[model samples]
Target: MTSFNSKKSLRRVSFISLSFLFISSLFIQGCKTGTKGIESGSNTTLEASINQGRNVFENSCAACHSFERDGIGPNLAGLTRHLSTEEIIDFISNPKKVIDSGNKRAVNLQKKYKSVMPSYSMLGKEKLASLVSFIHTYKDVPKPVDINEEGILEDPIPHQIEKSNFVVNLEFSFQIPASNEELPNTRITKLWGQPNTNEIYVCDINGKLYRVKNNKPEVYMDVQALMPNFKQRSGWATGFGSFAFHPDFENNGLLYTTHTEPIGTKNADYTLPEGLSGQLQWIVQEWKTDNPKGKTFKGSNRELFRIDMATQAHGMQNIDFNPTAQKGDKDYGKLYIGIGDGGAVQMKFPEVANGKHSPWGSILRIDPTGTNSANGMYGIPSDNPFVNITGEKVAKEVYANGFRNPHRFSWTNTGKMISANIGQHNIEAVYVIKPGANHGWPTREGTFGINTQESVRKIYKLTEEEMKDGVTYPTLEYDHDEGNAVCGGFVYTGSNIPSLTGMYIFGDILKGKLYYADESQMEAGRAIDFKEMRIALDGKETTLLEMTNNGHAKLRIGKDANGDIYLFSMNDGKVYQLVSEK
Candidate 1:
């Protein structure tokens, strides 16, 4: 037996010795390409290790062992009071060694159980230590008692849990005429309009922007011609991605568009790093519409910023200015850019010089009008989460991080910024983006564990304390069985649909499954259960199969100047407005 102080010293020494062994295991096991950022135990304290241990226990041991009562194995709640931490760790790591050596207590226990405890030596020393430490922390505390079977909720809204009966109908607005043989590439990816304007600006993934007036679409900008190599590897997910007209578009004629461009001298404002390997770069260009009342762009433009990306798959996807933010507000006139992780699983922390951040896998906020950065092109807001820090782990331009692919984000009139994060495998997440908060990625997908050596989708549970530090969980999440991808929509503030006025309207991209939930619940820091809104056409309830023709309709939720919402299909090229069922 050893004293607590002596064991603490020994634990430190063991942690130091475990580093070389852990790195060697990566080589021996042939490290998975995307799982390189799993937390290493170098700086872990006993408390932190115990948290890791709790995760391991839930994943591997909880099924067989119980803390209160014997399940398939002996009770583990107070095992520390009966056995020393060293003995428990040793026995769990190599039960066979302890039992086969004829150790009297180990042999007697094995005989009584009539089952051999499998050696968990492969859990690695660090994890194993963590697991034991977690178990050791449970001394005499009683297991928590749940009074209600459904569990107590904070500010629970009973109506939100009930299914919604709102019925929506799809009215064919117009198709985004295909420029080529591709079925979906030239279809409308986004439909946007500004206040006091009757015209709607629609853009496609093939580098084309069109102005829709009187249900007719006319070419507004030929983005494909602006880049020579865009057509080489472009599809429905690339090309001229999104566009945003400034809040004061009528006064300044300022507009912005994000496009995928080749990384070399074609547009010479930026260049690829000497050894950078990505073919295309995601860039934002500021354009002055020669005539604000005219139908087409006459080409007065300047480059705002560019990120040389490796893959065009998740390259810069969407951008928008905060519409509700006013003149004296902190967020006024700031453009929010949604950047993906460039088809990679993680991002580079301790951001590099020049404040690109991951530039990938982040939601960036920048002042397009100010010229305070080193490049003197765009300004980093003074209050941005990572604004003034230099040579530190944070990025000056990063507003919030830990996003895999934030396809779309919108602000409500109440100032809640909601983002839909496309998930990797099991689940899709919708988060309320907060400054300096991390919506877990690579490490987590939705509420599930996303990075594990054994499986990418294995669940990793976090403790309450860990969640409060820097990690932020989703406001709503659903498994893959519910929908494939989440299409972010706005919080309904329109008057036409009485039932949906205060509800958030969002849908699935692949299935066209529409859902709405009360925003007040989430705004108050409580998660609300979502209910799928059934779509009815021609006096009959229908599924996506009936509405979309096939099951492949790509659905997008759009908003107009009046804050009225509509749904668009990239597959069939139709737009539908939500109305009261007649």
Candidate 2:
């Protein structure tokens, strides 16, 4: 097992690499440099180039070093005084080589900073020149705006993206009884509960579900133990994934889970091609507790249904019960499962990408309460979009199709389902998922058309009619410039934070940035103008990245019975509740 510290280092390096790749791609396309100097009109052109460089710096270098003061790396303010622009570019591109060559400044800097500087080898000459230009012109570095006494950003950036009104506060720390120590910093994927229950249930990527009561966690289930061949890859597949309690849990004591189960001696619903070995299949099982109101759980488990995962990652991740669907309703007692395209990306497999009969790339709705079915242990809802269709390869269980990885989806109290679909490489999108909606996965990423034959960075606009048809474009989407992973959030209806009430809040797992959109606008089928959730710790402005202590572990959003929202840091075993400004 990789230690926590080593994982953090790996993530830091990975992020820097990704940032350079993204910014370098930008540089190749747009950042053509002209004559560069600090002279007046020269300053205008230079500033434009510098601004482009600044974007790269903020996204890549700013995480470690700042211009104002020493951080992970030495302060770059007036760095030109110590090194020439050529020397700086050389160091940025080849820090290890410079340091290893026994260069005095490089050695001294390495001595000053314990961590080794990552090399931006991927950055080509022009991009390096632009970065060097920004450093050369550095003046007094502008500090990040601090939070006011009311916990708002001291200086709000003008325009659409404003800071959030609320801040994140640690709710509790999990201590496992068996280990007799705090659990390792495993990624917490979901925090959920049954209706009218004070207790909260949290799941880790390792497949341990914990029941928290009085701020302590006890093992509710070891989901991994049940699957003999549960496969896991570092930083890729989620082990336990997610679970949802039946809305009538108080009476039924039933809950459901989505996980990757290895194909053992038992027959699998599907399997990888002949060459593949030791792969896992998606499992959606019904687990019933002995007492639904009890603090601890003793469960009886039964297999509801299973599907084969053609891809190692992007297996079934989210499962939820629609809170708005009541008894006797067509949707009542139905569970919604979100499945990725199973690696149909870049049209790796045409069947996975274009086959309507395949359930690999869609949201499936099924009646877990009923056992009557052709092959599946659960009942397929008659109202499913593909259920009635015949003579097609389409799986009858599909509710909605055409999403890459709908990692998380939730239904609001008002019956609206929202999804945060993880993009292939460039975009992260949020969608108001309508029944039978096609989100355009292999064909599109965000609003851009994807070439099924080859992956291209450029995005093409969808036709007006295509946007109006069954295909739904993103309600809100951000390019890779903003974030990579979109963690879906809930619509707040809680009274504790009146300002946050009726707002749909979400965050980026990689950047730890929180954003919210007005719920009213979302319900009206309009795109949202998302604003950043400005957070302050001890009156100092900060990002969720600083709060969580790990940048890569996903920042998950959660909700309790009261409708109050919470943020769970997968980096640390701490749960944070979103609260009103003190």
How do all models score by TM-score? Answer: 0.68, 0.70
Which residue runs does candidate 2 get wrong by more than 4 Å? 1-184, 263-265, 270-278, 456-458, 463-469, 523-525
* TM-score: model 2 vs. ground truth: 0.70
Overall lDDT per candidate, in order of appearance: 0.62, 0.63
- How does residue 231 of candidate 2 score in lDDT? 50
lDDT of 2 by residue, 79-151 (tens): 4443444555666666667567765544443332322434555556677777767655654433222112232
lDDT against true structure, model 2: 0.63
Q: What is the Å distance of residue 263 in model 2 from its true position?
A: 4.3
Clashes of each: 3, 4
Task: Identify the runs in model 1 with alpha carbons over 4 angstroms from their true place.
Answer: 1-163, 229-236, 264-276, 346-357, 390-393, 452-455, 463-466
Q: Model 1: per-residue lDDT, tens digit, 202-312?
A: 887767888887778888988778755553242325677789988878878888988876655344323322333454677788998878877888858887887765344
